[model samples]
Target: MPDSVGKPRRYRELTGLRLGTLVDRLRESLLFLPTVMLISALVLAEFFDHLDHRKIGPVIPERFQFAPEVVTVLLSTIAGAMITAAAVVFSLLLISLHLVSRQFSPRVLRGFWRDRFSHLLIGLLLSTFAFCVVALARVDVAQEFAPPYTVLFALVLTLGSVLGIVAYLDRVIRQQYIGNIMRRVLAESLYLIAGLPYGRHSGGQVGEPVTPPEPGSLGPSLVITAPFDGWVQQISRRGLMTAVPEGTVIRLETRVGAYLTKDTPLVTLWPPPPADQQHRIGQLVARSVVTAAARSMQHDIDFGIRQLNDLALRGLSDVNDPTTAAEAVARLGSLMRPLLMADLPARSVRDESGRVLLTPNDLDHAAYVRHAFDQINVYSADHPLVRETVTETIRMLQAASAGLPGREAARAELDRHLGTSRRHPLLTQAARADHFRSGDRRPRWRSATTRTG
Candidate 1:
């Protein structure tokens, strides 16, 4: 396949993934935003100091202008208060995170880490403290010059910081609600789904339709093994294609979200490259595959699914919160509904000329649906409310997948899960018979008392 064909679109996809990866990391980082705020605060201090030196902006009345000593004292007091307040604010946040991690699944901690609002709060508190410190140093008692504008700005920041603490508390409280947590996970999952090459709503295509070489005609193959152990995060198909010679056929042995141990077969190259070029090409292929210590929601839809499953499992644990488990089940159904409408890419990825360059084994809809709901089914078997919710969610998925192209297998998969749920030993004969129908409201509550097990 000619490099020119479909290369532009592929390049965009690769670049977008890199940019997305960087953004996700930044969002999760605690230092990036606060450091930015600190730098901006320093620049602002200097700018205000310049303004105060020339006395150009916002004329200050003689009566309002304070002596350099009073300004020094004011700045010191505000700086000390801000540092102490920062401590209290972050301590409260740490307490909240601990409680959240304990109550919900620790896997959900990523959500809290990516919270821009909390990051902004931290930046504000630190920036206020830094600004005061810089402004305090600028006080020139020898020249009898007090930066009135800078002091005024410090007071404003102090007031804003106090209000921000209140807002942060309110946000933390709302975020702790199980319903909101599910919604956040659902929203993030949908976002990832939207970026996928599959589905009618997606903007880009994985590759042109193409047929692979017949197995009998395919000759000897070279295998590339991973050098380290990590979870496969991203595979840059375009990068791989560009690194290989023309007409090279490559098949990925692992897909995103798969954990790879050292020496794991990473990829297979059919009609292997020349002896001298093999090592170089292998290095490029390995470079194209990104691995990380932990799973991320960037491209791995299953990670989000896993998070919801973890939440459900936590509910089914000693927490004994069936309502939370029910909420999680409903959200999982919502996550699957979009995939039903999406047309997933074929295993074969082709060039612009319809030549197959890579064959990636992506998780099909059935696998995702099973990954999303199966565990909730197993763990929540005894909880009537959770059981009813899981049944209803499977029904919802069935309805969404009905009549959609390329979704027959997924629909069958849902039917199988639904059937398995109905056969739970705790369910009555009547409940099993009426399983396909809407859950009976009275039995859901009545089942609590009529436990067969």
Candidate 2:
């Protein structure tokens, strides 16, 4: 059940999730920033033309002034040059992105897409082209008049574009480095983790308690099926609680990351609502749920973890780069620390009155840990460098999570992977296991049961 004191926090988290998803979509799109800049450039051009036409600005010195013919030629040249430069810069960026995807994991492409610097560079270049094009239309060679300030502004943009491209290239080169890529992914993942609706627990109930009906007391159940096939992206828990009538019990048939086909069971309502209210309630429930053609990190923790794991696997592949894989593993461990210490919310959430309102099938802490590292464990089994890194990462986590509810379960999972004997002596409750040594070259054990006896 959702914590009584945590209801407000949960609402804020969901609101943040919606905002984050919207921002992410805008950031990922190629047109959003450029389009905004283009419009700004056009507006600036018109403003300058107005200033020159009304003779509002200070008079320019004769040396700085240009004939209408000269101004038109310059604007045309700048327009053509900006467009050509933009084409070249982005073309090179695409090649770099392609190589980075091939070298690392394709998932990292999202990181590149979210890069603001690259966006700004392209926006500036395109906007410069747009400004010059608009300014050219304001030139009046027949009347022997040109917008002087506007022409000067176009020149300034041309210079800025040249300098921007150089800096953008440097950024692209540095971005290809594996360390930068991992750090970028880690930062984004951490942000997503902080806003997640888990970990806060209070003793008191938040809503009024409603008594549940006895087993089989429900006359008939209402099964809500998926309207279309797609991934379960975001489910608004608060929305679900608000839409349903008091005392209604909701069972979520799918989770945030699960994919559903058309007509698949999406939700089940127990002790179904009155005949007249069923359809309206169903529509509300559907509105609260969101689906997409692809997975995203907006509310899916697993998706972010998957990106890190993919990087680790790339390191373990024919590349034979254990250092890179170890780095990825270390970050994964850091990411898992907070999740281990916090109190995960219950699958069954109750109203203020303690009546169950929402039942969601979210993955538990142990399951999340396994999902983050299971694949790396398989491939890193033979590489001691990577294997020892995993060992130390889990050891740190086990020690950090001491006395927490999730500790024992995580410890048991560690034992399953590295064997009981491999559990570092310091982190174990039992007396030191002499067979294990931190510095041992080959720490391999035949099985968890392998013993000196």
Candidate 3:
């Protein structure tokens, strides 16, 4: 009904069909790879049958020959096994998701759902069944076109599928351990951060004002509104640069993780478009900004932090596993340190004319530090090991804040956590220092730093 339906397609639709994001989605999907493998196997089975037609006499040697009823029974059984295997794999995976979501943070399920090995194994079972179907169809006693090798290939596929089941089961069992999930999430998170432009570990820009400039008070700008309701996920910088007219600077009001409904202002076009280009400008903007129903780790680093925090929170549950919670807090520290040390990712993109075409809003570091450490700190206060880990993590972060923009936020948080619960008899003589006197070590996580006396 609204202009949301308008289109002038470019590289790909905003439905996450971008080559990079698609590759990620493919890894999460259990159907694609195995389907491709099964199709190839089927084609090969048929081709191999035709090629060796002369070698095998009619009736396919008693050893390989499969009577119609036997072929029917075998194919049916294989198909049944595939369904059973799929059910088992899916059930185990679903249970894993439930356990982690309940025990850990619900957000971490993305990490578990994207298990590529699990996806591949399940796909293999289905594809193997497909191979059998093709192979069985080639067995025709009437025309004497029994494929001896095809039957053999089917038998081999069945064996591989069985082995796959074993491998899948082993992986599922091992992954049930919280430590494994955290490690995978942490490793992948670092890997994700390394690819980001603001990357500190990979040697990108550092020690500067990583914040995007505030909108100028003097400029009156044109506001671009959302045409539909959805979660803002990604923006194609190259497409924005290519689509916008020369000599215009586009400033985004919405960050990557915002949810928008119809008529919500998304971008502010400086030097608003000439009247002639106004109608199509909305379409161009829509083409570049991608939206979806759920948040993804595809573009949001905060999503990664949320996942790790989930793990840490679950450990702090009344189940009395302070060690697990501490482990998560430590990993969260490592993840946050890099971002705090790195510059904000570049937001500006340009065109052939050297005009700034777009500048998406850059998120604040203060929010990240809070999100990374806040909840765990509150939950860990009663648990000494978890509290020490938090203090140790804060101390580590405090040492890094020397010249960083939000360094004070870190210091203030550390100072605030000190006053949280000093009544503990464990406070030693050294703990009596001013730093430990106040419950400031917890610093108002997620809150702005207060320059208190």
Using lDDT, give the best candidate's number: 1
The global Cα lDDT (0 to 1) of model 3 is 0.65
Mind giving the per-residue lDDT tens digits that candidate 3 earns over 1-453? 112222233344434335656676776666777677767777777676775575654444577766656766787688678878878888988898898777777776777778878777777777777777666666675644345667766778788889988988888888878788788777767776776664422213212223433458427667888787776667665445445566556676676667778798877776677777776777777766767777776667777788788777777776667888888888888887777776555555443444364445556566777678667655665566776777777778767776677456555654555433345222221233323335567533212111111
Candidate ordering by lDDT (highest first): 1, 2, 3
lDDT of 2 by residue, 101-129 (tens): 88898878877877888888889999999
TM-score of 3: 0.77
Cα deviation of 360, candidate 3, in Å:
7.7
List TM-score per model, in order.
0.87, 0.83, 0.77
What's the lDDT of the predicted structure labeled candidate 2? 0.73
RMSD of 2: 6.5
**Local lDDT at 247 for model 2:** 66
Model 1 agreement with the true structure over 1-453: per-residue lDDT tens digits: 225554575567667766766877898998999999999999999999889888786687666577889988888888888889888878877887899899998878888878998888889999999999998888889865577788888888989999999998899889889888888888878987886665322323546757666645778888889988999877777667765667767788888889988898888877788888888778767767778888887677888899899889999899999888888888887888886777666677676543355555678888887788767766665678887787778778888888887787787678666653344332343344444346543445345324322
- The reply for model 1, stretches above 4 Å from the true place, is 1-16, 62-64, 142-145, 198-206, 211-217, 353-360, 420-453
Where in model 2 is the C-alpha error above 4 Å?
1-20, 61-63, 142-145, 196-220, 353-355, 421-453
